[model samples]
Target: MSYIRGYDPDTLREIVDLRECQERLDEIGPQRSLPALLERVWLLKVLGRLDEALVISEQSVRVARMAGTRKDLLRARILHATVLQARGALPAAMQELTTCAEEAEGAEWSGIAAFALQHRGKVSYDAGDYDEARTDFKRALFLRQDAGAADEQLESTLLAIDAADRRRSRTSVAS
Candidate 1:
């Protein structure tokens, strides 16, 4: 499943439509068909509808748990945490990510672990905890590098770190 992590609302809706078509053809099982829900959640998130996205993501997580697929569950948990973070529920988001990170570690899913850690870093950053954010982002960067993720993603993370540092510097100067 080549699930695109970030897509615009229109593209995400198109993906959801395609998945729905497959589901109608009975090609994907009910328990296994989580991509559509996830796509919808992503669409809502892109639209800045955090409440709707959170509800859908929570449902997706339940479905993923019932499907008993580690990859699906990981994606659901990540999306759910993202929704929580967007809603400013940083503590809850961190808790969810921490659980996901532990699960990834147990399953030796380095990619998923890295993804979870990246979000954990984002939550810390949002909560004004730059030290923890930097630590988490560094760990995520290392894991993603070890997992051989695309250079584009690594570059994006580096840019994010640079932006964060610049913002911190400006804040310090202002204070």
Candidate 2:
């Protein structure tokens, strides 16, 4: 199947029935490239089919490894880490994200690096490490701003707020 370029996931979630979209995608799954598979995996993750998403995410990473375009591999790896995080495998997710962030930095891909850092912050937040989460989120905000990524900036801002709230809550409990 040909990749559906510019298929905005946020818009899709607001409009179409993701299940039907996923069903149509599955029907043509065998014909997919790694990019297409990555898209499908994201949809499955949103649908709470974590097991299926993890399987496809792994396959996407494997295929991208063979293909070896740094950007494509970076995207697949990030997605793999995300699925791991969703499945509550925080340590594995953090490890993969750490590696992905390093690779993105080495390649000078600011967008991926920013996104990886943001995801890292999210994992830290999930683990109740609010200080670390706030630190990473701040760094990600800087990167997103430098890259002119307004959408990412907004997300980082919201996450920073959440991290701050979490930190306050934790501190109050300890007091």
Candidate 3:
């Protein structure tokens, strides 16, 4: 189990200096385990290398599945869904995130559960399911709040909830 604490969603976005992170990743070449692969997958996604991200994402999921651990598999699936969303594969993204959310919740990985729910909320909103989107966003906000997670993540989820609510209202009014 490689150190995954430093590569949360915020940290992954902060790894915008890809050249530096890529170099660091190379230094850990021989030890490229599932955690490491997931890290690289996130960084590659941030760097807009969708194709490479997809490869690493799939590899990480495969490695995690072989590990036979719900925790590892849920995290991998979350990252995979993120990359799929980036690539505009919305249906696949939604599926992966939905499963990841459920598994993470059952595995008691609060952070992953909240993250998956947040993304799934976005996916639902994109799919025009405003009610479901609002439900997911509200649930994610509650989870993050209860978990004492970063306020930014909770705030983002809140904003999504508000947007979904407003959209639903507008749709109803239009009808």
Q: Which structure among the candidates has the greatest TM-score?
A: 2
Against the true structure, what is each candidate's TM-score?
A: 0.77, 0.79, 0.74
Q: Which stretches of candidate 1 lie above 4 Å from their native place?
A: 1-32, 171-175
User: Can you write out model 2's per-residue Cα lDDT over 1-175, one digit (the tens) per residue?
Assistant: 3222222221111234665767866775765587688887877777778998899999998999898587889889998998999899999999999999888878877778988988887788778777877777777777777778866355645556565566758777997
- Give the TM-score comparing model 3 with the true structure, all chains together: 0.74
After superposing candidate 3 on the true structure, give the runs of residues whose Cα lies further than 4 Å from its correct spot: 1-31, 169-175
Give the whole-model CA lDDT for all candidates, comma-separated.
0.73, 0.75, 0.78
Flag clash pairs in model 1. none
Candidate 1: residue 23 lDDT (0-100) = 41
Global lDDT of model 1? 0.73
Clash number by candidate, in order: 0, 1, 0
Q: Rank the candidates by lDDT, best first.
A: 3, 2, 1
- The residue-by-residue lDDT of candidate 3 on 1-175, one tens digit each, is 2222232322122224667666766765745588678888877777788998898889899999997487788888888998988888989999889888887889777888998998888778777888998899888988898788976676677668778888889899998
lDDT of 1 at 155: 62
Candidate 1, TM-score vs. the true structure? 0.77
Tens-digit lDDT string for candidate 1 (1-175): 4333432321111123444434433443333358878877766665567787788898999999898498889989998998898888889999999999889978988889988987887888778766677677787788889899998557645654654576567668888
Lowest-lDDT window of 10 residues in candidate 2?
5-14
Q: At residue 93, what lDDT does model 1 achieve?
A: 94
